[model samples]
Target chain A: MNDLTIIITLIAIGYIAGTWAEKRHYRSIEKREREFLDLPAITIKNVDIDDAKVKNAEIVYGGAVISVDYFKRILAGLRNIFGGSVKSYESLIDRARREALLRMKTMAPDATMIINVRIETSTIGRKSHKKSVACLEAFAYGTAIYLKG
Target chain B: MKYTARMPETNVNVTPTSPLREFFVLLSGVIAIIVGIYLLLGLALNIIVPRIPMTFERKLAGPFINSMASVDRSSEKAQTAQKLLDVIQKRYAKLPYTFTVYLQESPRINAVALPGGNIVVFSGLLEKIESENELAFILAHEMGHYVNRDHLKGVGRALVFIMISAMLLGPDSSAGNLLAQSLNVTEMAFSRNQETLADEFALNALHGTYGHVGGSADFFIKLSKEANTGLWGHYFSTHPENLKRIAHLKNYSRIHGFAEKLLRNIPAIINKKRPA
Candidate 1:
C-alpha cells in the first residue's frame, strides 16, 4: 500500500511536470528553429560550392540529454506488456533530437550552412554496474562551412 | 535546388492523438486484463481446490512447512492442543487429513490453519485460553476450515500468482509488483461468509465432542474486552464483527438446542507462560 502511494505520487508529478516542460521546450525549439532556418542542416555529404569561397569548414556538434518522466516510463512499461508502438517515448526522442539539432545550429551562427549532419541517440542511464540517472543523450554533429566574401 | 526552408505542413512524426488519452486507454486495458484474470482465478479455485489430494498438498507444503519445524511440537502446550484437536477430529470433525499443532513463541494471539493439516498455535493465544472447551472450539474452527477447504482457497490465488509471475515474467517484474500491490492481500483472506460457516462448524463440533456448546463464543468474548485496550491483533481488530460472530454463535446454539454446559478446564500447561 505504501509503495503504491509513492508510485502514484511520482507518476502524478511526472505527468504534470513532464508535460509542462515538454511544451515549453518545444516552444523554445520552434522559435530558435525559425531563427536558424536559413542555416540548413542537411544529411547529404556532398554540396556544390567552390573551394576558394569556403574559407573555413569545421565540425560543429551539439548534444542533449533528456530524462524520462515517471509517468512516461510507466506508460512505456505498460506498452512493453501489450507489444505496440511506445508512443510515450516518441516525443522524448523527438524532443532530444530536435533540441540537439537546434543547439548544433546555435554553435555555427556565422556558417553558410551545415552539411553531412548525423544525429546519434544512445541511452546513458539505468545500467546494472553504474549508479546512473535515467536519461537519453542525442548527439548531433555536422560540418559548418564558413564562406569568405 | 533552392531550399525554401519551410517547416513541414504538419509534424507527422508524432501521432496527433493525445498521449494522456492513450495512457488511460492502455492503463485501462492492463487493469481490465488483470481484473479478468483475478475473476477467472477465483472461478478456477472453485474447480481446483477439492480436486487436490491430501498427499499432493503435503508434498507441496513440504518446503515452507519444514522451515517452521524449529517450533516445538513436543512441548506440553503443543501436545495438549494437539490432543484436543485430535479429539475434535476423531469425534465430531472427521476430516481426512491428520492435524499437527505447532506451538511457536510469538506475541501474536492467533492460530493459522496451514495446508496439509498443520495448525500453528502461537503461544500468545494458548496462554490466554481459560478453558479446554475454548481450546477445543478454536481447534475445531481450524478443522472447519479444512472441511470446507477454505485454507486452500485462501492461499491458492496468491500461490498461482507468484508461480505465474515466476514462470512468465521474471520474479521481479514491475507488473507483478504492481498487481500484488493492487490486490493488497490481507493476512486473513477468508471472506466473512467463510468465517461464519467455520464458526458454525466449530459450534457443531463443540456440541458433539463436549456434549455442549458452552464455550463456543468464549474466545470472542475475551477478545472483545481486550479490543478496546488497543493490543488485540488482526483476528479481533473489528470489535463489532467479533460481537456479531458471538451473537451468531449464541443464536445458532439456541436454534440447534445445544445447551451450554459446565466448561472443561484446559491443561495447566496451556495457561502457564513459557520461559523466555
Candidate 2:
C-alpha cells in the first residue's frame, strides 16, 4: 500500500510538472526559433554560394539531454506491454532535437546558413543495471557559413 | 534569395496527442484485460483445481515448501500440533493430505494452509489458544480447505499473473512486482461462502474429535476483543469478519445439536510464557 501511494504521487508529479515544463519549453523554443529564422539550418551538404563570396566556415554543434517524467515512463511501460507506438516519448524526443537545433543556430548569429546539418539521438543517464528509459540525448551539428560583402 | 526560413506549420515528428488521454486509455485497456482474465480464470479454477492430482500438486509445490524445510519442524510445539492434526485428519476429516504442521516464530495470530499439505502455525496464534479443542479447530479449518481445495483456487488465479509478470518483466522488476501485487489484492477470493463452509467443517471436526463442539469459537471470540490493527488485519481480510464467523459457527453448531463441553487444556510446551 505504501508503494502504491508513492507510485501515484510520482505519476501525479510527473504529469503536472512534465506538462508545465514542456509547455514553457515549447514557448521558449518557438520564440528562439523565430529569432533565429534568418540563420537557415539545412541538411544539404553543399550550397550554390561561390567560393569567392565565402568568408570563414566553422563547425557549430549543440546537444540537449531531456529526461522523461514518471508519468510518461509509466505510459511507455504500459505501451511496452500492449506493443504500440510510444506516444508519450515522442514529445520528449521532439523537444530534445528541436532544442538542440535552436541552440546550434544560436551559436552562429552572423552565419549566412548552416549546411550539412545532422541530428543524432541516443539513450543515456540510466542509473540502474536493468533496462529502463532514463534520459535521451539529441545532438545537432552543422557547418556554419559566413559570406563577404 | 528566395529561401525565406519559416517553422513548419505542423510538427510531423511528434503527434499532437493528449498524453493524459493516451495514458488513461492505455491504462484502462490493460485494467480491463486483467479483470477479464481474472474473471475467466476464476471460473476455470473451479473446474480445474479438483482435477489437479495430488502427486502433481506436491511436485509443483516442492520449490515453495522446500524453502521452509530448513525451518524447525521437530520442535516441541510442532510435534504437539502435528499430533493433534493427525488425530483430526484420521478420526474426523480423513483428508487425503498427510498434514504436517510447521511452527513459525511470528507474532501474528494466523495459520496458513500452504499447497502440499503444509499447515504453517504462527507462535502468536499458539499463545492465543487456551484449549486443545480450539487449536484443533484452527487446524481443522485449514484441513477444510483441502476438502474443497480452496487454497489452490485462491493461489491458482493469483499465480497466473505472478508467473506472467515474472516471464515478461523479469522477477525483480518493480513494474512486474506491482502488477503481481495488484492482481493478488483483487484475485484472492477467499469469499464468504468458502469461509462459511470451512467454519462448518471445523465445527463438524470438533464434534467428531471431542463428541461435542466445545471451544470452537473461543479463538475468534478472543480475536474480536483484541486490537486488530496491524498484522491482525490480514487474517481478518483473508478470512471472514470475526463477528460474522463466530455467529456462523454458533448457528451451525446449534443446528447440528453439538453442545459446548469442558475445554481441553493445551500442552504446556506449546504455550507462550508471559513476561513477569
How much of the real interface does each model capture, measured as fnat? 0.32, 0.59
Provide the lowest-lDDT 10-residue window in model 2 chain B. Answer: B183-192
lDDT of 2 by residue, B119-228 (tens): 89888889888899999999999889888998898788767766666665566667767776666556445466787888889999989988998899999999888855
The candidate scoring highest on TM-score is 1
Q: What is the lDDT of candidate 2?
A: 0.86
What TM-score fits each model?
0.78, 0.74
iRMSD of all candidate structures: 3.7, 3.5
DockQ of all candidate complexes: 0.30, 0.39
DockQ of 1: 0.30
Native-to-model Cα distance after best TM-score fit, residue B168 in candidate 1, in Å: 9.0
Q: Write the per-residue lDDT of candidate 1 for residues B1-276, one digit (tens) a residue.
A: 678886767776776667788789888997688667766887799789989999998888877788875677898889989988889888988888978899899877888788988889898898889999999998898888888888898788777777665664467667577777557443244366778888899999999998999988899898888765556746654222788999999999999999998998887989888776
RMSD (CA, angstroms), candidate 2: 4.8
